[model samples]
Target: MNSSLRSDANTIIERSIQAVLPDEAVRRALSGRKFSGRVLLVAAGKAAWQMASAAAAQLGDGLSAGVVVTKYDHVKGDIPHCTCYEAGHPVPDENSFAATQAALDLVKDAGEGDTVLFLLSGGGSALFEKPLVSGEELQNITGQLLACGADIVEMNTLRKRLSAVKGGRFAQLCAPAKVFAVVLSDILGDPLDMIASGPACPDSSTCAQALAVVEKYHLTLSDAAMECLKQETPKQLDNVETQITGSVRQLCAAAAQVCRQLGYEPVILTDQLCCQAKEAGSFLASIAKTHARPEHPMAFIAGGETVVQLTGKGRGGRNQELALAAAEGIAGMDNAAVFSVGSDGTDGPTDAAGGYVDGSTRAALLAAGLTVHGVLAENDAYHALQKTDGLIVTGPTGTNVNDVALALVR
Candidate 1:
């Protein structure tokens, strides 16, 4: 029965990812739009290669030139017309700097009669980093932010101020040319200007807002990074056509479909679910407690990213934290389980995508001599789940649509 539940959970997650792939959604969105001039394809992220390949298949002979930057292991061979550059992610390296320069060059060379197709997905922020601040400074600030447990939005707010290409600067690079951005949103509420720090979209965030995030997180920035934030650059949003081709809505819909097929009523709690990881987990667990019964099977689904304020050097992501926190509240409840995971199949710096917890989780942990408080205190939910054999490890799903959490009450 446990195996069956795991399989079902995996299926739901996989289907959610497949539903929000940039290539698939972009193709559909572009079907009606007319592009008569030269088509220049520029894509970046963990799914860049796959997105590029899909665009190429749909574009066929229409694509005139192209370039893409992706994470080191994500590149899959070379496209005939597009230059594919593999770069570092989560932390920008020298290769990411070079790739950003190359992408800028490509856009700079685009003519008024050309159409630039910019494919953006999650991880683009790290894969194509051109620092407005020094590389060393960016590295320092990023490390501090990670260790501090700042959420992705807060981290990205600082990133946009530090980056040369982010915050719609990439779109500005293609000034006179018609730029169409196909974005796969991985942020809560599918904020087009926040996903990947809005490389090709207009940023609504101001320098003041960026500074505020740093202050709120109590993050110490390097001198160079601080100077970059102080620079008064007017917000620019012109001649760029930005559209959210995919998002968490796709994931929720997919999960809903699966629930229906399984003869369970699926209630999409929200596609914009956002809050502190542990708090959100506890809230969901409470909701499950009210709904769960022996005779009725129901699935509660939510999408959106949650924040984890790092208090310990534990090896876990927000999803793992959510699952663990929920476990604390639903310890003795039968016929109920809570699962949370990043849609990208990587949560934080850990190999496991996320973890799952049920009424039996507490008993299992105690049997294995694992104390819940110790795990939670260390932010080591991943290890706690591991002891109970509840960690869900799915390496790099190649797509991103934010995070997903499901509460199943049967």
Candidate 2:
């Protein structure tokens, strides 16, 4: 492994994540916004805790009440008047229902003069849900979509149909009251309706599109779920005003800035990378092989979320899988390394944020009787990277824009 390259990668990761944190963004968004009566804050997703905290500090005694629902272990501390609840992510669970109910209740009796300060981010589909179907069925359907490699847009399209709070329904529930939403986009292109299933934004996706996703994935859904898919989400909403504060584009820019500071000429390949994790890794390695010049440091960056088609039962996330898959293509390159990490600081179900690979990583794994192909086939990049000391762990980054993958050549 190239220690210097690894250090640079770590610096880029840290600085970039810090740049995209929602604290300043939230404060700025709320600065000039005026509220008539009540400003009831409802924050949901991975950044819910952080966004809520910032809003609480900004609003102070002005905030009438607040509710925060975020991924488990994400609630760092208490926010002044807000009731904080830690819930499940990627799949809604019992706590998800409870926390969502609390938010719903907080806004249910809202008057026309009241304002719902809805702070939304990625993972809100699961963290801020009131399922129309049974909770068990919802979990099963979510698992099926995940296993079949449905992308975030597709997953949320189907998920919004099955939930009472998604697809602009939450905004409807907070009806008569205006909603001022500060959104942190995690999806490529920053589609407002698709982020966190767009609880407050008008859903552009149709019922046909929802059914198409189900058919594409061959997802086995309950009868009630199928019925929900046939129902159309709200096509238009007038009570909500949205301000998009951050996105993967910002994440990529931050990384590129750090790369330039590290004396590397940075090229942003794309900010909309969406494909199979393994294929993306291999493609990035190919770019490194074709572009790297001797003694001329360069950084190639791609920022977007990738999908993993699960054919194996092992544990891993898309970022981890992407990094591990790059191991073989750049195995003999002394000055090349590839790494990918989730902005949320958690990859799949593992503790590691992502994985890293360089020229020596392959050999180290082989020395431990592990082959890249074998580990990847089992979908166990977490353990494989662990054996090679290639796992990148950043616990609960308090933000979620997307994943950023980089190929470093020095």
Candidate 3:
């Protein structure tokens, strides 16, 4: 019975990922749209290659010049009529700077009648950036923001001010040319200004908000980065059309369907679950504990991005930590299981998509001489899950819609 439940959980997660892939979403968005003149493609994010490849299939020979910047190893293969570059994600590297420069150059030369097809997805804020400050200073500030436990919105609020191409600046660079952005949103509320720092959409975040984040986190920034934070981002954008092709809401719906098919009563807890990683895990486990029964089977689904305040020096993503915490909460509930996975198939800096924990997970760890509390306290869920075979390694799924977490009770 436990094995069957695990299989069902995996199937639901896979269905959720498939539902939000950029390929189908981009193709559907471009079905009736027609461009008169040249189409310049610029894509950036974890799903950049997949989205750009899908758009290329539709544009055919109409695509003039294009640039694709994606996370390292996310570039599956060559994108026809487009140059693909792999860059750092969660943190911008030197390659990210160079590739973003190329993307800006491609859009800068767009003529009056041309169309700039911006293929955006999650992680673009880091994958596509030309900093207003030096590369070293930019990297330093980004590291500080991440380690400071700031949420995506808070981190992006500061990023918009620090980047030369963010906060509608990229759209401004492509002035006179119509800009249409097909986005695969990984943001909690699907805020256009927050996704990828709103390179092609107007930024609603002000310098004051950015400053507040810095003060809240007590982040120490370089002089140049500090100065950039005081400057204003572009609050207005011209000739830009933004369309959200995929989101966490869609991901949760797909997972719920799969759960129903698997003979579990599907309950969507919330599609906009925003909280600390461990807190989210504990909450889901609490639901599982309440519903766990021999005769009753239920699946609780939640989707959204979760933040993690890094207090330990050990390694693990937010999803991994969430699963570990759930393990503790559901330790004695024999029929309960909880799983969390990022839609992009890479959570935090780890190769694992996320983590999974069953009622036996905690005991299994103890049998193996591992302490759940100690592992979680050190933020070492990756190694702990690996020992218990709780790590879900899906590699890159070529999609991004934040994260989907499910707790099943039988």
Candidate with best TM-score: 2
Residue-level lDDT tens digits of model 2 in 223-278:
87899999989989999999998999999999999999999999999999999999
Tens digits of lDDT, candidate 1, 270-363? 9888788888888889988888674667889988888777778778888998988888777887677889988877887788888888888888
Q: Model 1, poorest ten-residue lDDT window?
A: 1-10
Which parts of model 2 are misplaced by more than 4 Å?
Answer: none
Per residue, candidate 3 scores C-alpha lDDT tens digits across 34-120 of: 899899999999999999999999878888889999998898888779999999889899999999999888877789999999999
Q: Tell me the whole-model lDDT of each prediction, alpha carbons only.
A: 0.81, 0.93, 0.89
Q: By summed lDDT, which 10 consecutive residues of candidate 3 come out lowest?
A: 1-10
> Which sequence of candidate numbers ranks them by lDDT, best first?
2, 3, 1
Among residues 3 or more apart in sequence or in different chains, the pairs in candidate 1 whose N, CA or C atoms overlap within 3 Å are: none
Choose the strongest candidate by lDDT: 2
TM-score of 3: 0.98
Using TM-score, rank the candidates from best to worst: 2, 3, 1
CA shift of 26, model 3, Å: 0.9
Model 2, total clashes? 0
